[model samples]
Target: MKKETLFIAFSTQKGGMGKTALTVLMASQLHYTKGYHIGIVDCDYPQHSIGEMRKRDTDLVMKDEYFKLQAYRQFSTLGIKAYPIKECTADKAIDMAEELMQTSDKDFDIIFFDLPGTLNSPGVILTLASMDYVFTPVSADRVVLESTLQYATMLNDNLIVPQKGNLKGLYLFWNMVDGREKTPLYKAYEKVIAELRLNMLKTILPDSKRFRREVSDQRKSVFRSTLLPADKTLLKGSNIEELANEICQTIKLENHGNQ
Candidate 1:
């Protein structure tokens, strides 16, 4: 039997919301730490940041002794190579993913798409509609919140409620939360979101520069990488593990096994 693969995306109408970073982090965590086979379709068109990151990660692993040793140990022990990242336009993303699933030697549990940030991009709506689950990152900013709410409302009204596509759930989660921010602001937004009846994730990611770091020769431990799972030490207090756990539970994904 062909493996059943979940199509998921971390997306938002607004840009610089950490969608790409979250995608790579979650994919890495689930694939390496949780032993789930993974694939990534980089559909951000002109940028293809995830695909580029993969190239840079590969280079770093080759040049850096620490990263090289880590990669060797990981692959040697797991008996699996790094997950594949395919690049394509928004319109061709689904087709590319399907082809990848059919052709890949390993059975994938999930295939993530890093989509274009703007809705004006060709096939953005179509791609978003096709996901089994869509997770949007929101912040405390007024403009970001407004844009996200409008975009979420549009998806809820047009695709989700009408059952137009494969979308099973649309989730919004707080991202880039600062400890210094007033509590009342978050409470107010939570009340508003509740009134709007949108699904919100319980896990909120705190603002940290670590999210921007990937496989680099300068860093002693990796926080984010396309080839390796995050270092266990860095996961403490990061809440990324919590977010991953919640997402897996929400999606009804079985643990399968872990390395």
Candidate 2:
């Protein structure tokens, strides 16, 4: 029997939303920590960061003895695969996704898209509309929150609502949340969240140097990194685990055993 594959994208209309990093983080956590078969489709056009990161990761594992051992234990026995990144035009996104989702016993159970952060790109609308779910990460900045809400509304009105229950959905989650107490920005966000009735996720990723220090000029996600001090290590691991679990529950994917 052909297994079902889940197609999801970490996307937003505005740039600087950490969409690419989120994709890599989610893919790594779900595959390495949670034992799911995962792959990434790098469709970020001119600069395919995730694709480049995959190459860098492969090289580090091969050449650096310490990195290799750490990565090997983290990955353990499950296979983690990444398809070659493509410079796919928006017009070709659907075809490319369909090609990637051809399921078999050895195929990926989940495939993530690292899309360019714009709707103007060719086929972007069509490609985004075709996803099983689109997960948009937004910060507390007024401009970003407003734009994200507008984009979410557009997706529902244009793609999901009119499709007569094709079951596609859009989700919003807070990214880069700071540790400060109830600030005006967060209060404003809560107001909008309630007003829009958006499918807000429960996982809020706190602002941390772990995300920045590890991701900068490197291919290692925190999910596969072994160099963190004890405190940051525990915090990062907890956050990643909670976020991964929330995602799986939201998407209704069974925690298939170590495949």
- List, residue by residue over 28-136, the lDDT tens digit for candidate 2: 6666556677766777887877666666667666787666665566445444433334446557666676775654346566878877788888767877876888898
Tens-digit lDDT track of model 1 for 1-259: 6557999999998988999999999999888888888899999999999999999999988998888988899889767579999999999999999999989877788999999999999999999889999999999999999999999989988999999999999999999999899989999998998888799999989999989988777777899899988989888878999999999999998655465
**Stretches > 4 Å off in candidate 1:** none
Q: lDDT of all predictions, in order shown?
A: 0.91, 0.69
Task: Assess candidate 1 and give its TM-score to the true structure.
Answer: 0.97
Clashing residue pairs in candidate 1 (N, C-alpha, C atoms within 3 angstroms):
none
Candidate 2 residue 101 Cα shift, in angstroms, is: 3.6
Per-prediction count of colliding residue pairs? 0, 3
Compare the candidates by lDDT and give the number of the best one.
1
TM-score per candidate, chains pooled? 0.97, 0.84
